[model samples]
Structures are given as C-alpha cells and as structure tokens.
Target: MSNALELLKTRASPKAADLVPPGPNEAQLNEILTIAARVPDHGKMVPWRFIVHPHETRAPLVEKLIANFRAGKPNANDAEAEKQRLRFTNSPLIVTVVSKTSPNPKVPDIEQLLSAGAASMNLLNAAHALGFGANWLTGWAAFDKSSKELFGLADNEQIVGFIHIGTAKGEVFQRPRPDLSQIVSKR
Candidate 1:
C-alpha cells in the first residue's frame, strides 16, 4: 500500500493524558501548521484561525478557566473540575481552531464553518503523520462565552476544536470503526 494510504489507515486519536512531553520543535510545529492550512476552502474564504498555547501560557490560562468554571457552577463535582483541568494541562501544546465567517454575497456561514472543520482535521492528520500524539477536543469551555473570551475569541466566533499535541507515552488504542457497508451507499 502507498505511504499516504497507510498513514490514513493508522490515523487515530489517543487520549490526551497518554501524550507526553518532547512535543514538536519549533520547526516541526511550523511545518505542521503550514500543512494544516492547506484544505478545501470553498470560495477561497479562509474562515479559520489557530491559537497556539505554549507551556508557559497554558498554565495560567487554564487556571483562570478552571476558576471561572468552578465559580459559575456551585454543584460541579471534583470529577468535572479535574476533567477540565486535564483537558488543558495534559498536552504540552494546545492549538485552538477558531471558526469565523465573514459577510460574503455568495458564500454562507455553513460552508465557512465546514472549512474550519477541514482545517482542524488537517491539523490532526499533520500532527499524527509527524509522529506526535494528537487529539481534537471540545467541551463546555468551547461554548462558554466567558471561556472563549479567555482565548480572545469574539462572541461571533466559535471554536471548532482544541488540538492537543505531544509525544506518545503509552499504548495507543484502536477503537472500533464504523461499518462502511452500512454507512456508504453507491448512488
């Protein structure tokens, strides 16, 4: 099989906690981001942006997020808070994909949003191909306006995903795949 086909076949998202340090160096990250930007963008409307959080920035940023999350929800249990903490802190690098739509006479918001999703998928593939452990994640924080504010995302903009990138530390599980026979139909 071709290398490209093999790469696609093996692509899978490992747990963020299973991802360790020694993430992509500066050059590797640059290459990954460059490749991620190459996607099928309809109408040439590049309606997505990436927000990178390095180790230093990610620490405090997550703290603020945790604080805000806990403050708003008095009934939030320890598990909930811990889960949120791990989501942001486990990976050494976090890249957030922000979806935004510009007013265009021909293009609608859905197409633009789809382009953003493409960008996110590209990011995951690029990271995996580069031999890094990566996963695309989104939760309450992504939808919260206040949390979005922490990332400097305007209310009009929505988050497509938060990509965690790092070196693999443990086993990478292969979950079950959907049955193509049932999902795919020839026209």
Candidate 2:
C-alpha cells in the first residue's frame, strides 16, 4: 500500500481555534476537494455535498450562531458566549459537508451516511497534505434543527462535519493515538 500507514500516522489535526488566515487559494482548494470527493461512495450516490462558506458572508452565519448559543444558554458569560460565535468567523475557510441521503433499494442509508463521513475525513486529510491546517468539528450547532434548516437540508439530510481550514497560527503538538490492537479486529 506504499506505506500509506506512515502518512496516516504523521497526520496532525490542528485545534479549530488555532487556524488562522490565508487559507487555501481557489486552485489549491479545488484540488483538495477533488481529492476528497474520491472517497468511496456505495451505489455511487455521491451522498455528500460541500458548501464553502467564503470569508465574506461568514459573519452573518457567525451572528446567527451567537444568537442560537445565547438563547440556548441564557446564563453564559460574555466571553463564554463569544466563543461559540468566534468558532465560525475565526476560520479563513469553512467547508460545510452535508450528508444528503438517497432513498435507494441497493444501498442502505447507513452506507451513504458512512460515505459522507468518509468524505469529510478525506477532506481533512487532503487539506493537511496540501500544507494547510484543518479541523473537522461538529458542535451543538451542527445538530441544531434551526441551523440545519438554515443550510436548506432536506429531511433525509444531515451535517457530517464543518471542516475549518486555514494556516496554523502556531505549532500544534500531536497527541497520542489509541493502540490499533484495542480498536482493530481480526477474524
């Protein structure tokens, strides 16, 4: 497998908040996404979609998130409250990966969902390999019904991840990984 495991071992996901400006340019971003779209899709449904929330209009989305958080947590202090909003606006580029399921006989919805999730991971890896920092996060906002509605997702659709990509503001130390034996199985 050309020692793919080595590349996997070296991958480091930066903290979402630590991602700074100067994100992927158009050509680079497109290349990374094209690579990501190569993830396995059962039944070839291509059950995932990407919405690149460009730098310009991200403020409104951040405002909406702040309102959602403030309303949801009435007692949250200003700093704590601001954190939720900052998560959105801080990233130079945010790729919203939506999992749009297909009602098909040959492919189970679960498989489609997995494919979408795989696509998100592929995007994260692609960004890192392209010399950028990326973080795949799904906070409370991801599961919020209102937020999903705002994204225009249909009933069968869901948010797999919000990939935050940008230059790393500082060094990100890689944490330890779980032992493969603990999670892997052999039959």
Each model's C-alpha lDDT?
0.89, 0.88
Give one digit per residue, the lDDT tens place, for model 2 in 1-187: 6557766777788988889888999998999899889999877899999989977778887887788777777899999977787888888899999999878999999999999999998898888877899999999888988788778889999999999999998887799989998999989
TM-score of each: 0.95, 0.92
- The per-residue C-alpha lDDT of model 1 at residue 11 equals 90
- Please count the clashing residue pairs in each candidate, in the order shown: 0, 0
Instruction: Report the C-alpha displacement of residue 128, candidate 2, in angstroms.
Output: 1.0
lDDT of 1 by residue, 1-187 (tens): 5998999889989898878898899999999899889997878878999999986678888899998789778699999998889888989899999998988878888889998999999998999899998999998888877888888987568999999999878778989999999899998
* Candidate 2 global lDDT: 0.88
lDDT of 1: 0.89
Each model's RMSD to truth, in Å? 1.4, 1.7
Model 2 sits at a Cα RMSD from the real structure of 1.7
Which 10-residue span in candidate 1 carries the lowest summed lDDT? 147-156
With a 3 Å backbone cut-off (N, CA, C), the pairs that clash in candidate 1 are: none
